[model samples]
Target: MSEEANQIVQINSSEFSWNKKDGVFHFDGAPALLFWDNAFKIFLSTIMEISGPDASNAVFETTGFRMGLLVNDYYQNRFTIEEVIKKYSEIYSSAGWGNVTITSLYKY
Candidate 1:
């Protein structure tokens, strides 16, 4: 891992919130579903850019699977904080955000 990869990427957390009590995530003061459309649109654009038009769907599916793995491992105590960071770094690197680090993870 490079030094640049250790820096966290900044996002506006104010756009999203989570209710720990109910285990629910909200976006823009509403349920996450309301925000998914726009979020997916942005994500699809990046997917197309990275994987090209034809492979975007497959790439998206694979990416989702990898993310699930990371989350599952985290919840199952299969990875330490450093391990989780490394795994996420690999994911972001593959997704064309190699130089960026993620500062937070929201349930939504």
Candidate 2:
């Protein structure tokens, strides 16, 4: 949302859903997932609404990473970035969307 912040904010859509029973999140076709249990409550934008595991799919382009470089800030506030990616990839394991894929990530 801010060039200086390097945060590309996006809105949630139908692809993002909630699994109330499991307390996990599914986004953009990703599987039910959990991260830090409850670090992210709600990620809001004009078009998107995402939570926890679903939040991982929201990263369209470089956000804080880019902002950090711009401001000469090298530290990643959250260490789970890599872990989150791994988990997402793991859930995707050889399973294709089978034609139901988001052509582009929403960013504003």
Candidate 3:
């Protein structure tokens, strides 16, 4: 397999720790994996400010699986594994303003 063959990858996540402010979901664990979109990024930031340093994230696995489902469910749809990977890579890269990272993509 060549690198060019696979296009799309998967959403990447960083380590996030669970935090607790007087016993709350303040991401105080240890920064296991954090993923955020527009809404999520805001949420993460807010939480961080409110609580403390508990969680860290880069991106999500699937911003939304609806599209992927559609393609997969389509009877006529037939994408090679590599093709699907490519598609993910394109989206991940395209999501610049979104500011997302590339994670492991599914082989199938």
Computed on alpha carbons, the lDDT of every model, listed in order, comes to 0.58, 0.39, 0.43
lDDT order of candidates, top first: 1, 3, 2
lDDT tens per residue, model 3, 50-86 = 6565433222224246556654664225566655555
- Residue-wise lDDT of candidate 1 within 19-81, one digit each (tens)? 555556544344543335568689789879987877987887888999788657544565566
Per-candidate TM vs. native? 0.31, 0.19, 0.28
Error of 3 at 99 (Å): 9.4
Better of 1 and 2 by TM-score: 1
Superposed by TM-score, candidate 3 places the C-alpha of residue 66 at a distance from the truth, in angstroms, of: 13
User: Which runs of model 2 end up more than 4 angstroms from their true locations?
Assistant: 1-14, 32-108
In order, how many clashes per candidate? Answer: 1, 6, 27
Compared with the true structure, what per-residue lDDT tens digits does model 2 show for residues 5-96?
33222232224445555444554434445444234433334224443334644553446566557433322343354533443443333223
> Residue 42 in candidate 1 has what lDDT?
92
Badly placed stretches (over 4 Å) of model 1 are 1-40, 49-53, 78-108
Better of 1 and 3 by lDDT: 1
Question: Which of 1 and 3 is the better model by TM-score?
Answer: 1
Indicate the residue-level lDDT of 92 in model 1.
46
